[model samples]
Target: MKSISKYWSIFQITLINSLAYPGELVGRSLMIIPFMWIFYQLWKVTFSAAGAADGMINGLTLRDTLWYLMLAETIELGRPPIARTMSENVKDGSIAYILNKPYDFLLYQFSTAMGETIFRAMLNAVFGGLTVWWLVGTPNHPEGFLIALPAIFGAWILHFSINAMIGLSAFVVEDVSAFTWIYQKLAFIFGGMLIPLDFYPQWLQNIAKLLPFSSAIYGPARLFVTPTLELFISVMSLQITWIIALTFALAIVYRRGLAQLTVNGG
Candidate 1:
């Protein structure tokens, strides 16, 4: 209990620190507005072009599609750059100081990452939701937000696990920019950030759903639009599976990285 409180304190401190620059936080979140606008325009055209007699394409209406995208953007943009930050810490030798602290490094990073993610995600949801509302009205299942909340948290955990693994590579190679870049592109495509996985061909959808990326972005966002109890269970189940798998993978990487870690600061 006492040890848990320590990480809780770290989370609380970082959460407060993130708000120390209110203007910057809000400004960064504001970028979601333009992203939502562009998505609305792009999808509106695609929907029109499809011209489904029932006004549905791939099991989603335009409004559903827009709302889905807003949530997806919120999740993606809300996350802090954990891999990059870790890489930088390694390069600068600040990681040595962090290691001296009496806390598990992985848990400490998780606490800080979640602390940074909370307000950014909320702000993005607010700004993006408003923009999407103006463009497409309210979501089909407004209650879905509450239902999807747990999955959203799970999504972040899954994201952290994967990213921390990439960051751990910093112990071997100082620059992980290439790795992060590839990860981002894979997420954009397989996680359904730009287009919902339902819109993909059947074979592609199957492939994407099998990947961990879908659990991070598509699962929660899709549940937000549909919001069925069964879907919630499926999403959470898959997310938890990935979270467990990736977390174990991350622990292995962290241990190996720590072995290779060499800090040279007197």
Candidate 2:
């Protein structure tokens, strides 16, 4: 318990340090704005052209698509750059010191990442959601909101686990940056960041359902516009399954890596 508290305190200190750099913080926050604007405009144009035919594109209304875009932005904000964090620690040899500590390094990173993720989520909910909502009314539906709660929470857990697995790769590879970049691009592309999964071809959509990336964005975005009990169960179940699988895999990697780590002076 004391060890947990100490690691959490360290995480809080890191969070405060992040908040102190106002310029960097604002700049990072603003980076998502243009992407949001582009997607919003593209969706608006598509809906305008489709008119009543928009339903052909997955039975989605213009408003539903807009809400999907908004939800995607929010999810992106909540995602932690765990790959980068692990790569940095490994490169700087800080991971050695972390391993020597009496605390669990994985838990320490997870807690810190969660803190940053929550903070970013709040900022995006206010600034990102507000900017879009003001221009286009809030995408609110009582049923959607009710269903979204569980979906979003499940998505966060699944996302964190996926990232933890990626971070674990740092133990094997000297440069995980390239892998991280490719993984993120694939996540955004197939995870429904640019467009809803329903917009994808049937075969692609089926494949995506089996992957963890879809739970991160597509599952929750769909919840906002199409509330179904089955969808909720499926999304939550997949997330839980992936979390367990990834955690087990990471445990193996950690044990093996620790055994192999060579200490010169100790």
Candidate 3:
């Protein structure tokens, strides 16, 4: 009870703080507008070129693909710079202050992120829905909203942990931009950000399925469009498993990182 309350306070504080900087959320969502437009045109051209080859490229029409793209964009944009901030804190010794706090530093981070993510997700859905309506008039599968909720939450957990792990790497490497960049690209490519993983070669699909990247953006967004009981269970299960494993991995990393910290002046 106390723990929940304590984190609840952090969550509330972060939520209010986000309002102070309303532009960030709006700006981030707005920035995706142009990109979404570009994708719309590109996909339209591609589908036109495909021209009766098949309406389903890896179980996606032009419309379904656009919907999937919106979800993917939202997830990617909604992520706060957990890795960047943590890496900078570690580099500058500011993590000392965070460590001195009563709550777990990672939990504190997660709570703050959750607040921001909730706000962003709501706004992103609105903006994305508008954008999709403008371009393609209802991207299909309205029922997916329900099926995707748990999967998206699970993806958020996995994303947070993966980023925390990258941030913790700063303890040894001191700079993690390269790592983050690579991770983002891999998530974009293998995670099915640009397109569906099913369109990829069988070998690539196998590799992507094995990685958490697939579970995060790809799997959840895929769930939003596909929405089958079996697929939902499979995606959610993968997301849950990745959440547990990545969180366990983060615990180990944070433990070691804490041990390595140098605390002196009171």
Candidate 4:
């Protein structure tokens, strides 16, 4: 308990430092605006064509598709960019100091990442809210906001855990940047960032749902269009399951990695 509290304090300090860099925060926040606008235009064009041919694609009207894209863009931008940070720390030997601390390194990282994620989420929500209003209008389903809160929070946990696992590979690999890039591309394709899962083929959609990537954006984005208690429970359950599995797997990796570190003393 004391160790956890100690790490939490450190994470808080890190969170404050992250916020102190206003220029970096503003730059990253501004970058998302153009990406959101590009996606909005692309989806608008795609939906216009699809709606003309078939009347609707995957049960979504052109309006619904735009809203889906809006939610997805916001979620994608809001997700913490932890993998690169972790990889750099490990490659530079900063991870060794973290490991030597009395607290669980992964837990400390998780806490700090969560703090950063919450801050980003709030910023994105404000920006996204205004953008959606101006572009697509507010979501028709009022209940969508209620469902979104829990789903987004669960999605954050799932994202953090999976990223932690990927970052942990730096203990073995000489370069994790390539691997992180691959994971990011996969997430963009399969995680419903570029397009909603409903637009994918049935088998691909099924496989995507089974993967941790979808929980990051798709599940929460779906809440805005088809908010339901059952869907919320199901999405949250999947995220919880992934979080537990990844946490256990990371624990094993940390134990073994530390043992190797002790043996090498390098």
For model 2, residues 97-163, the per-residue Cα lDDT tens digits are: 7777677877887777766776676666566666677656777574785688777777776666666
TM-score of 4: 0.89
- What are the root-mean-square deviations of the candidates from the true structure over C-alphas? 1.2, 2.6, 1.7, 2.3
Ten consecutive residues with minimal summed lDDT in candidate 2? 257-266
lDDT, candidate 2, residue 192? 88
Of candidate 4, the 10-residue stretch with the lowest lDDT total is 257-266
Provide the overall lDDT of each model, using Cα atoms, as 2-decimal numbers.
0.93, 0.73, 0.86, 0.75
Best by lDDT: 1
For residues 176-209, could you state the per-residue lDDT of candidate 4 as single tens digits? 7788788889888888888788889999999998
Candidate 2 pairs with clashing backbones: none
TM-score order, best first, reads 1, 3, 4, 2
User: lDDT score, residue 46, model 4?
Assistant: 82
> By lDDT, is 1 or 2 better?
1
Best TM-score goes to which candidate? Answer: 1
Q: Number of clashes in every candidate structure? A: 0, 0, 0, 0
* Cα lDDT over the full model 2: 0.73
Model 1 Cα lDDT, one tens digit per residue, 162-247 = 99989888888778999999999999999999989999999999999989999999999999999998999899999999999999
Give the poorly placed runs of model 2, Cα more than 4 Å off.
Answer: 1-11, 53-56, 142-146, 263-266
Off by over 4 Å in 1: 262-266
